[model samples]
Target: MKSIFRLLFFVIGLSLVNAQEIATTDATTPDGVGFKSKNEFYIFGDAVVIGNNILSKDDKKAFNVLQVNNDDTKMRYVDIDRDPTTFSSSQAALKLPSDFKKIVYAGLYWSATYAYEKGSRKQQKGNYVYKGSGARSKIVNQIKFSLPNQEYQDITGEVIYDGLGSPTHLINSPYVCYADVTKLLKEAEVKSGAYTVANIKATQGYLSGGSAGGWMMYVVYQSPTDNPKYISTYHGFALVNKEEPLDITFENFKSVEKGDVKTSVVVSVLEGDSDLRGDEFAIIKQRDGSFQSLSNGARFQQNFFNSSITNNSIKNRDRLPNSENTFGFDIAKLDIPNYNNTIINNSTSETTLRLKTEADRFYLYFTAFQTEIEQTYFDDIIQDNNPNASVTAYVSPEIVRAQPESDPSYNTKEKRKAYKYTKRSLNSKAFKYLKNKKSAAIAGIEGGYYVISGVFSESLRADKWTTKLIENGLDANAFINPKNNWNYIYLLRSDTAEEAFELTEELKTNYRYRDTWVLKANLD
Candidate 1:
């Protein structure tokens, strides 16, 4: 048997772009991954706003699809351009770069083109509101393409239209169509970007005179071979844990410090255009559940992705593109070379990359890869942990002593809550919830004011911190805040803030309780 990691990473928004229909001779899709296409249906257009193209030139690097809804039931809207240079047609054609190579990936995007919502439109409904027969397909589904000699040819590949479960669209719903044009594209590849042009046109799509929208298409493709090192298969997973403004960790991600394999983090704009991905960031969570800003230093890498796109000049990854909508780059700083040693002197070993984009409007995908070679070796050792274990990141006395020591006293504004599990026993109900949340081993509980410490979204990371603290000569334990459902590194609860402050200093100065923070709760 072989290790298989199947991910639908390409699903950003707008019905996940029908990634399941992608033909791959290599790996199997894991269960509970793909979705039914018909259920994601809509008429040729819904929520028609004004736009000439599906995306502005700035949005070219990323797929621009829109969805509406609250925490539940994401409703999507797209503008499909009907062809022949009509008034403000949203139609777009992908022009290959002159030095194009094999197209490893492509997607045909169709959005709600309902041109007109005359009279009045309904606002609310049951379960979820959907298009009725009145909103059925206004145009015929006959699809055409712009190829070399022939002006328009019928596309032969299977067209998987998006969400058609509704009674009306069951007949003909707007959808994302996937046509394998590898042969056609390869034949035209030699033309040096000029010989080939592909555009989608639902030319025969007919609409009622009363209808508001009908016609055209939008398509986006990624031809990685244009660069010398192509993406054979981007092996990684998407972190959609809770959607926008998320803190995520992929356990399967492994690498050595200074390793050849680099981790890339790309956040697609489902709803933003002012800045690049990773442009504005909130530092890792603090005791009061606030974040520090990295806005000034947030970067954009010019030459990292496609140097040609930047006119051979390297663009800063954190800076917005001139086009303004599309941006992605590798976050070398966030890579965890050694899991355990991620903490040196109680400071963050792993980088936290969260965007403070206007209300955090984005989706994230992460990929890891080394060069195409037999093997790659790393000679640098930024950190090394357990002696008996492999030379990776581990917590040791040297690392602890190397950390700076400082403790702040009596600040109430931040509402910092720090807790350390005191050996003092608790009631059955509280203990049960504690167990469900998880219990960490402590050196021993003591009666003293305690300091605020670390916090983690994952139990494994929290546990490692607990162990490291205990080893470095202190009673440390993992506790769960059943309220927020987060794991934490805390100290025994203290009777007074003064005593707690004293202990905080002791731990910082003596035991290297470096990044410790306070934990809070209402006793009454």
Candidate 2:
């Protein structure tokens, strides 16, 4: 009787232990703790499968199913059995059947949180966050990859620009823009290794270890609107920083004077290790008339190539395009306390500056990982398969301004006396129709809109007295040396000159621009 009782107790205790282990395991495993990382560094989210039927009508009539074997049927068949693995690269994408309609986008969620510990100046021991055993430490600079293809990869790093604090910046990875829903889901799935399943199953995973570790998982969903080109679909857990304010000064983007408009200034630090020179550091000037040290941040290691210099005509300076420099150094961040501005000792404030000339130029704080980007079909594939179908792609931004020209002749018969003040009356009429026409857009050689500078020249004496008007604050060069072929014009993008003339009657100051032949500027 004693032996029998002992055996029964032993069986019950083992069963209880087994049940406890199974309860804590992920959905996919009865006793397994989590999915293993394919590469040495990181684990991926579970793979998800999603597809929708594409139905096509024979004609555009109310009810037309006249032909059973038409273009619509062929399109539906093509969409039914698409191989997600085919569109695995950064730019790889698949096409949706044109005859078929209705796309269902599906994704997966693979979330796991862990304790995060960050090194700090105040604590010699360092600060730490407590998390459950399954939690993962945050990863700042790490590599991320998609399944089935090994050639394509991205480095994930933190971007702390705009004084918005810090957010994940996945730089240097190839980006994709596609309209197909099936292609996006395929790129967002995990599809390699031992714990593979025939169909995607819900699973709990543990992701821990790193400076700012936490749990994470893969999540998938469909977009309500038709995904436009140049847009991206992304999902992941990350830290959100405070929003940074922007101040627009005419010094670069516009022609307005400093202190003319009250705006919040902020600096956006670009992440990368490109060649930077001492002159680039001078770009940021403090109020006390001191320059920030050029070698203040971490020394970056370059993995790419040699250095080359070119004259950046757009910014009116010679600089490296691929190199890293202070990108957005707005004045607003300086005004705020406990933000970007810092008071050193008793007299000066120090602010770290950052920049990127081109989109590819990134500053080096940590390794940049292309965690995820929009997935799309390759340009050649989309064009070959469907000639009429258009694939949206991301393009670079270009500056559109008046091209420089040769010096104006200024050799009129009476160089100094042409279009002399003809008792002109600078009144409300000078800016009569202009107040309502404050803004206008023009056709650009590049893809985006180009705002034309307003040209104000007396139609009768356009060529004459243009120099005098230019001295009084008009872009004489734009009219004199235009890429579109025009000489002897006075242009203004702001209301400064026009406003000055309109108020001439009230002040009677400046000796009378009213008599100086004023006319509304016609912007082209």
Candidate of highest TM-score: 1
The per-model lDDT (C-alpha) reads: 0.29, 0.20
Q: What's the residue-level lDDT of 273 in candidate 1?
A: 22
Structural similarity to truth (TM-score) of each candidate: 0.31, 0.17
Candidate 1 residue 346 Cα shift, in angstroms, is 22
lDDT of 2 by residue, 254-353 (tens): 1112112111221212111123221122113334534332221122112110011111111101111111211110001122121233211111212223
Off by over 4 Å in 1: 1-52, 55-134, 138-143, 147-150, 156-175, 189-524
User: Which residue ranges in model 2 land beyond 4 Å of their true spot?
Assistant: 1-251, 254-283, 286-289, 292-524
The 10-residue segment with the lowest total lDDT in model 2: 1-10
- lDDT winner: 1
List, residue by residue over 170-204, the lDDT tens digit for candidate 1: 32222333344444544552322211122322211
